[model samples]
Target: MSEVAIIGAGYYGFKPITDEVSFREGTFLAAMRAYEQCNIDPRKDVDSFIACEEDFNVGIAISNEFAVDQLGGVLKPVSTVTSESLIGLASGYMLIKSGLCDIVVVEAHSKASNLVSPEKILEFAMDPVYERFLNFHPNYLASLEARNYMEKRGISNDDLALIIKKNKENGLLNPRASYSITVDLEAVKKSEKIFDPLSEYDIAQYTDAFVVVVLASKEKAEKLSNKPVWIEGLYWCSESSLTPLRGFSTNALELAAQKVYDRTNLNPKYIDFFEIDDRFSYRELMHIEALKVSNKDTIKKDLREGRFSKEGDRIVNASGGYLATGVPLDAGGLARVYEAFLQLRNEAGQMQLKNANRCLIASWRGIPTSTYAVCALSNGA
Candidate 1:
């Protein structure tokens, strides 16, 4: 059996606005950087290409068509994943493991600034019969979850604030953190609530970003780079599209985590770090519990004790996560994967962890959906 390894990663335009480069230009640049890092010739060495983007997000019905030439996929097997980009990575992994392709490229991005009405677009994703009729801000969906999570788990506003404080402060070390800021729990607690207890600062700001990752078979990985981050396990899950059937307090992350952990035969104790979703401040705590790293009763304590802080026993979202880095829609998951890649390679610079060996990256497609994905990466062969 051939194991897939992530040999290279490239990123660009994680900004509030990127006036300089168009979406295709950013995609080309990121793809070029990945090819350069892995020493692969896209025109010849690549076997297939997977791009992750929503047609609605890109404002084009057939966005992948415009991407083919730019990504160097010209006549090669090029496809798209409408979900998060990690699904694209999973696609590449399967392609290699099945002995169909030796090297595969995965790309995803966000040009959120280009969206004339982001809310309307998201509203359109809601279930027509159920959620769309409510016609409330999509955050209302998250609010219901947030309130339920808080009451059941005994999570307080201050507990949620701690996450915002830690992540944004941690973002101080991240060059890509567009919304990074320094504030106390009081500030977060006092901020105007968009959906009671879920304050303005509790939500991750949307930004633009482009990420590209290259996955290759074991043979190609060893040949392409001296340090190859192996994909130990990968899984993605989607619960009910109907919000009524979804577990608001407990997200799909647990289901995804269960599969990955079972396949990898590794537990949270083996993970040196984590880069899970923090699109909503409360969701961070909720997800950690769902991932089984800790439970509702204990995670808030762990957080308050600084156990999950950058310098604490368990470091999570050291790149500040989406809370600090800003969410790039479907691209957000790949960004987490990219950050884990940097950490495993000891190339995270100021955000680098000492002797970091294994890590987990998880993501949730925000609001009115229960989509989640998880993948484990190890520096060891």
Candidate 2:
């Protein structure tokens, strides 16, 4: 297979909601910026485009159409992948590997501002035959999983608070992050409870945002820029769609991680930086265990020891992750990939890791769904 590289990445979103630009406009702005940063003219350089989106989130039947005009995708081969943003990115990579396209643009965005009730949207994701009959709130499902993780792994709510506080503090250094606040364990413990053990702060905040990334074939990447982060390996997996039938604590991320590891010939210890979907505080801990970066029982312990701090050897979520950085739904996964590109290219500014070479990015859909995608990225293509 041919190697694909990320030539440039760009993101656009206000700290909070912004009225200055519409959702499609925000996507275009980011897309244009990324193409320009890579020194590629969209009209001439891009061979195809992949957009990640869902219907209810964008308040439109065909969300991709809203972005096509500004993304320079009109009259170009453009398709919408109704899954996680990184899944769309994985498709773009495969497109290049197939020798079909040399330059592909992947875009994803979320206007959380438009959703009157995101819970309603999430409810639609539940299984209509069995699970939806319970009429349980989405948080209830996440809470059930959290409970199982704690019971089996001996993780405490205090440990979850630490993760929340740490990610929020890390966000303070990230200018693009929406919720950059300083919260201590006590504050997190005292925050209003959303679920039994999960507090409001323990969950990611909804925000309006967009992210765009440009990928090129190895040959094209080498000629366009002196620095390009190679797509070492990419893997995605989905477990039983029926959540009740599967182990709540068993995430598909482990399978995805194993696949990437085998394909890239890399290990968890070799990873210099990482960005994992942390829509819930417990998810950070859950994914850390699934990725095998640390033992399931010791993840919270390692987190408190600062093993995953941005300044630490194994930097995790240096971009503040979805928790502190704001969850833009479909856009959240690409946001993580964009961070990997920046850190690998030495363009992450204050959040940059020292001497970073290899990075891993993992993304997951919300609970009741086992969809996941993991990718390995390196400085060498």
* CA lDDT scores, all candidates in order: 0.88, 0.84
Indicate the residue-level lDDT of 374 in model 2.
95
Top-scoring candidate (TM-score): 1
Q: Candidate 1, which ten residues in sequence have the lowest lDDT sum?
A: 244-253
lDDT, model 2, position 333: 82
Tell how far residue 165 is off in model 1, in angstroms. 0.5
lDDT of 1: 0.88
Model 2, range 99-192, lDDT digits (tens) per residue?
Answer: 9999999999888877888887888888889778877778888888888887887888888877787788888878878787888777777777
Reference-based lDDT, residue 102, model 2? 96
Which consecutive 10 residues in model 2 have the weakest lDDT in total?
A: 10-19
Question: What is the Cα-based TM-score of model 1?
Answer: 0.98
